[model samples]
Target: MNTKWWKEAVVYEIYPISFKDSNGDGIGDLRGIISKLDYLQNLGVDVIWMCPIYQSPGQDNGYDISDHYGIKPQFGTMHDFDELLKEAHARGLKIMMDLVLNHTSDQHPWFIESKSSKSSPKRDYYIWRDSKKGLSPNNWESYFGGSVWEPDEKTGQSYLHLYSKYQPDLNWQNEEMIHELYKMIRWWLKKGVDGFRFDAIAHIVKAKGLPDADNPKHLPVVQAYQFFSNLEHVHTLLRKLNEEVLMECDIMTVGETSGLGPEQALEYVGDERHELNMVFQFEHMTLDSPSTGTSRWESRSWTLLELKKIMSRWQTTLHNKGWNANYLGNHDQPRQVSRFGNDTEYRVESAKMLATFFLTLEGTPYIYQGEEIGMTNASFQQIGDYRDIETLNFFELAKTKQMPEDKTMAAIHAKSRDNARTPMQWDASEHAGFSDAEPWIKVNDNYKDINVEAAIQDPDSIYHYYRKLLALRKQHKVIVYGEYKLMLPLDPDLYVYTRTLAEECLLVILNFSHDTIEFEWPDQLAYEARELLIGNYEEVPEERKEGMLLRPYEARVYMF
Candidate 1:
C-alpha cells in the first residue's frame, strides 16, 4: 500500500506496428514514435508500453525475437531507438518494452544451433522429447490450434510450442538459458529502459509429471489451457528475475497473465514479494464468451451484472492484497467502444463511461492508442482484408474442419486479431490520415467521424474526458493510493465504488445501462460530497438530492 511511482502511473500501450508510420513504408517505426511523444505527454500519460521491436522474422508480429541486443532493421537502427528512448524520457515519460522471454523465433541462432545435431550443446536450451508411441509427448494443444509439439525432422524429436510452430518454447529448466535471459534483461535495463511488460510470463514454467489434459467434456482447448496455465514454479522464476535484475532498478514490471485470479495474482505482485509491479487479468475480456461457443463475437448478450461482478471481484481482491492494471482494451483485443459501448448510437457517452470506470479504480490504467478518440472496429468486406497471423491460421483450420463458410466467417468476425491491429486514425483524410500510402491493415469505416483531430478540438470529446480523468488522478492522492470500497454491490444498473485515503474520499459512480437509473448515496460520505471531478453526459446535481439520477451511460467522480 506504500507509494511507488509506477503504482500511480498511467500507462499507454502503443502497438508500434499500428501507431504511426513516419517514412511511409506501410509500417510504423521508432522514428514515428519519437515524433508523437508530445502527443502522448499532452494526453497526461506517465509510461509508454511499447510492443517488441527486436530483430525478428515477424512470424508472430515481433513476439518471436531473433536478437535480444539489437533492433529490427525494419523498425530502424539502434540509434533511432536510443533517440526515441531519450526523447520519451525528456518528456517525463518512461518507456517499457515488451519482453518475450517465454519463446524465441525458430530462426534464432540458438534454435538453429540447437537443431543442428543431436549432440549439440545448445540442444538443451530448448525443450525436446522423443515421440511417445510415435505421437506427441503429451496431449497439450497450441493456442493457435493443433498439437503443442512440432516434430523436428533432423533430430527425430518433437519440440514444444505453446503458440505457433515458428515460436518455439524455451526450456527454463536449463540453467544456461535462464542466465542468458537474465543477461539480456540486464542489457536492456542498462540501456535505460524503464521496465518490461512480460509476455506470457505464466507459461514460462510448466506443471511437472506432465500428463494428457482431461478432455472428457467437449472443451478440448479449454481443458488443455487448464493443464499448463500458472504452473507451480512460475512465481519462483518471476521472483528470482525480480530480485536479481528488476528490483535493482526503479522500473515497472507487469506480467501478461491470462488464467490467474486475484488470490494467485498476489503471489506475483504483493507488497512482500519483489516480483512484478502488477498484472493484466482477462476476466473482463472473456465476458462475452457464449455458453454454447456458437456465436462468441457477434452476440451482444453480456448483462451489466456480469460486467460489474467481473471488475468488482478483481478490484476488491487487489485492494487488500496486490495491485491491478485497469484496462478495457489492448493491442490483442478489440477497441473498448466497439466491444462495450454503443458504437453506432451513444459512442461518446459510453466511451467516457468506460474511461471513468477504469481511471478511478485503485490501480494503474493503460490506454490503448486511438481509444481516447472512441475508435471502433474496422469493417472488412472479406476475410482477405485481414493481415493477422492468428486469423489466417484459424481460417485455414476452419476449412480443414469442414466448417461452413458463414460459421468460419462468424468466428473470424468475433476473435480476429485484425480488430486490434488496424492503423491509428489521425485525421479524416484518405487512409484515415494514418499514412500517405495504403496502411498495413484497413482503417475503420467510421474513421472520418472518429479521428484524433476532431476529438482534440472538442472539449466534450472522449479524448478530453480521458485527459481530465488522468489530471484528476495526478492531483488527488486518494485516487493514487487509497482503500477501495464497493458500494451498491448488488445493483445491476449502477456500478459504484469509493476510494478513501485519510480525510479525503472520492466516489465513482457509473451507470452501465442505456436507460436512466437512480441510486441512494451512501450516508457515510453523502453529507461530505463537495466537487465534481469528471462527469459523462451531465454534471452532478445540486445538494439536498434525495437520490442520484444518472442519464444514459452517465459516469461521475465526486470528491468528499
Candidate 2:
C-alpha cells in the first residue's frame, strides 16, 4: 500500500512574485508569505510548492537562476526565508521549493566561466557546438520561440538553451555538474525544506550527439520537444539522483515532464523504479492547442469528452503502479476558472464544479493561489502589460509573421503565462492590496468584484466551497485512496465518476455546461443509500434517491 503522507496531502502552489508584498516594493517577498501562513493553514493545504525564489536574472520570470544558493533581493534575504520556513512548519505546513535543475541563467558563475575559455574546467558544463558558416547545430526552436543556440562573441561556437538564451541548458553528462546539483539539494535539505518540484526535468537528457529534429520548421515546437523529452537516459540520471540525494531524506519529488504519456510517466514515478514520487504531464494542457502545428498560441474549441478521456487515462493508467500529481492550473498556465469554466455569471458555481472534479480525483491536488477566489484571466489588451518572457517572445514572432493584431492580442489574452502571474487581489484597495506601490505588472481589472475580501464575505463564494470540499476530503479516506471509475464517459455536459475503496463509495457528479439537466444514474451503477457530502448549492434536507435536476455548473459529492 502507498501509505505515504504525501499521497493524502493537498498542496497550495504559491507564485511568490504575485502572492503578497510586505515591503511595499510592488513585489511579493518572503515576508509576505510568512504573513499568509495562517491563511494557508486555515485553507487546509498540507504543502506549499513555491515557485522559483532563487537569485535570478528575471529573463524567464525567476526561472533563470543566477545563483542556486542565494535568495533574490527583491524577495528577501536568506534570513527571511528561514523565518518563513520556520513559520510554515510551526503551522504543520511543509515547504516545497521549485528547483530548476535543467538549466541556469547565463549570468551564473559556472556559465560565465564556461563561456570565458574553451579550456576552462567547467567548459563542458554547458552544451556547446561548433557552428558551420554561422548555422546552428540543429534547427530546434526554444520554448520561447527562437533558436536554442546562442553564439559566443569571442568564439564561433554556440551553446544550447532550451527555453531562453539567458537560461542555458546544463550538460547532464558532466558528473561534476551533477554532483554540484546534488550538493545544492543536500544544502537545502539540511535547511529543512520538505520537498522539491523539478522544473522541465525531462529536457535534461538531450538526444545523443545533439541531433537535429526532423523537419522542425513544419511542426509545432511541442511536437519537436518530444524528440528530446523523456529520453531513456533521463531515467538513468533520475535513478542516480534518487539513490544519491533524494533517498537520503524523506522528501517528495515531482518532475515537470512535458509531452509524456501514462506509460512514460510510470517510468518516472513507479515506486520500484526509484526515480521520483510523481510527474506532471502536459497531454491535457495541450488539448486546446491547434492540432495542425500552430503550437499553443492558436486555441481550439475542445470538448468535455476529450478532457475526461485524457484525465481518466492518466488516473487509471497510473492507478496502482505509480502516483499522480493532479493539477488543473499553475504558474505557467492561465487561471482555472477563466480557462475551463464560465468566469462571468456562473463563476462561483463553475469554479466549485471544477474544484469538485479536481480534488475528488485520485492524486494530490495542487491549488494555485487565487484559484479559491475564482480568479479569471488578466485580459491584458496591450502587449506592454505583459511581463512573461514566453509571451513577449511570441509577440515578437507574431509581428515577424505579420499575424493580425486583434488575433495576436486575443491569443495573448487567452494563453499568456502573465494571465496567471497577475497580482493577487487581496481586497479592493489600491493595487488589489498586493502592494503599496505600482506592481511589476497591472492587476486584473475585475479586482473590485473578484478580490479575496469579497469572496470571504459571501458564504457561497468559490473560496468557501473549496474550504468545505477540502474538509470533506479530510473526513473521508476513500477520497484519497479509492479507485476511480468514470461513468457516462460519453456525456457532453455532465462528468460522473465513482471512487470506491473497501466499503466507501463516493459518487461525484459535475455539470460542466451552463444548462440545467436532469441526470439519472445509469443501470451499470447500482443504487445505494447515500448521503450528500457537499455541493455548490445550499444543502437540501431531502435526499436524492434516484436522479436530480442539476443546475448550471452544479456539483455534488455523495457517500454511500
Count clashing residue pairs per candidate: 0, 0
Candidate 1 lDDT over 68-180, as tens digits, reads 88899878999999999899989999999999988999999999999998899999998888888887888887887778999999899998899899999898899998999
Estimate TM-scores for all models. 0.96, 0.98
Q: Tell me the spans in candidate 2 whose CA falls farther than 4 Å from its real position.
A: 216-223, 524-528, 539-545
On TM-score, the candidate that comes out on top is 2
Positional deviation of residue 19's Cα in model 1 after best superposition, in angstroms: 0.6
Give Cα-based local distance difference scores for all models: 0.85, 0.90
Clashing pairs in 2: none
